[model samples]
Target: MNRLRANDWLFWGSVLACYLLQLMPLPQALLPLKPWWLALVLMYWILEAPDYVSLGRAFVLGLVGDVLAGELLGEQALRLCVACFILMRFRARLRFFPMWQQALAALALLANDRIVLFAIRAVSGEAAVPASYWLAPLTGMIAWPWVFLLLDDARARARVRES
Candidate 1:
């Protein structure tokens, strides 16, 4: 029975910010290193506030992301659904871990996302993914700490403001 949180606006704001970040253009050489912003934000919500961000929401978000990115329909939806499924399965343990360990978990989750991306590209007969394809997860791992801290601080501030 997860009611709408008072800080729900903060959650949606951060998600919109992530989507905007994901859409930002990057230099060709730097493109492979851009962290998966949407995945990181979704993982944070899933880990910290599972009741608010459920599997169905993840699927819907993924579909919207797919359309925005001009990707094959249902591609991101399936990947995000899988990510949510795993996160939800392990939420009991992950939710309580220290931030560093949680970042490690996020790293693993982002890696899973990359694997899914690779499979999708292969199946679609796209150019072989470069070896640098693995860099995004590592970049995402590095960014997780900062993203978590900022979002957590924002959520806390929003709670205090509401109170």
Candidate 2:
């Protein structure tokens, strides 16, 4: 019971941290390069603790993110739901892959996220995004290993403390 409680806090705390990171400001020149921090963190949780992170949870998180970022209300929610669905579908195989392989998978997932975002914007008749807008997923791919390791370490420490 204590372990479960610890895990819950760790999960939600990491998610909150990701939201902060996502909302943090960057120089205008670097804005397009900002990684999809929330997506990356949520992916870790979905893969590591499936029961704790579901499609509905992803949707809620994304909705919160959209409101926080001032994007279209359901944009992030839809993107997150799609990413969550894909991750959950392949969670079994992804869970056991080597970290390098997992990072590659992260790239694919993030790229798919970018595509979803593009489709959403296009349908909404938004202005064409600059080419640099696509760079975020690459940054996200590079950051995946570190994000995974950091969260994994934090989770381990949380369990150890409870033990």
Candidate 3:
């Protein structure tokens, strides 16, 4: 049987911070370029502790974002769920990949999330957002390594404490 790991309070703390950060007001000029902070945190936890947080958690967070952002209901939730599910399903292989490769995979996942959101908006006849909506994935891809390293360090510390 797998050994018991410590509770992931730090992980959840970071996740909460990410969500709060997402809700923070931004300058109108920079709003379009803001990265998907909540999505990034969800991806991090899904990769690090699939047992702790799963697609359902991601979906709920996305739903909260949808309500806060005033987007169509279930829009972000569906995308976040699909993204987390895919990440969890392939996590073992993903863990072995190099940092750059993993970031690339994350970028692809984020792109997929955007596509789903875009498709949903189109179906509902919402006005098309600017091309800048695509930039979030790229920025997220760049920021992922830092997030991974920081969270992984926390995981390592947690593991050591448990032992």
Top of the candidates by TM-score: 2
Worst 10 residues of 3 by lDDT: 1-10
Cα lDDT of model 2 overall?
Answer: 0.90
Error of 2 at 132 (Å): 0.3
Error of 2 at 81 (Å): 0.3
> Any residue pairs clashing in model 1, and if so which?
none
lDDT of 2 by residue, 15-128 (tens): 899889888899998888888988888889888988888788899999999999999999999999999899999999999999989989999999999988998899999859
Model 2 worst lDDT window (10 residues): 49-58
The lDDT for every candidate, in the order shown, is 0.85, 0.90, 0.80
Better of 1 and 2 by lDDT: 2
> Candidate 2: where are CA atoms >4 Å away?
none
Over 4 Å off in model 1, which ranges?
Answer: 1-6
Which lDDT tens digits does candidate 3 get at residues 7-77?
Answer: 45776688677878787888998776677877777777777667767667777878888888787898888
Model 3 lDDT at residue 136: 84
Candidate 1 lDDT over residue span 25-49, tens digit each: 9999999899988888888888777
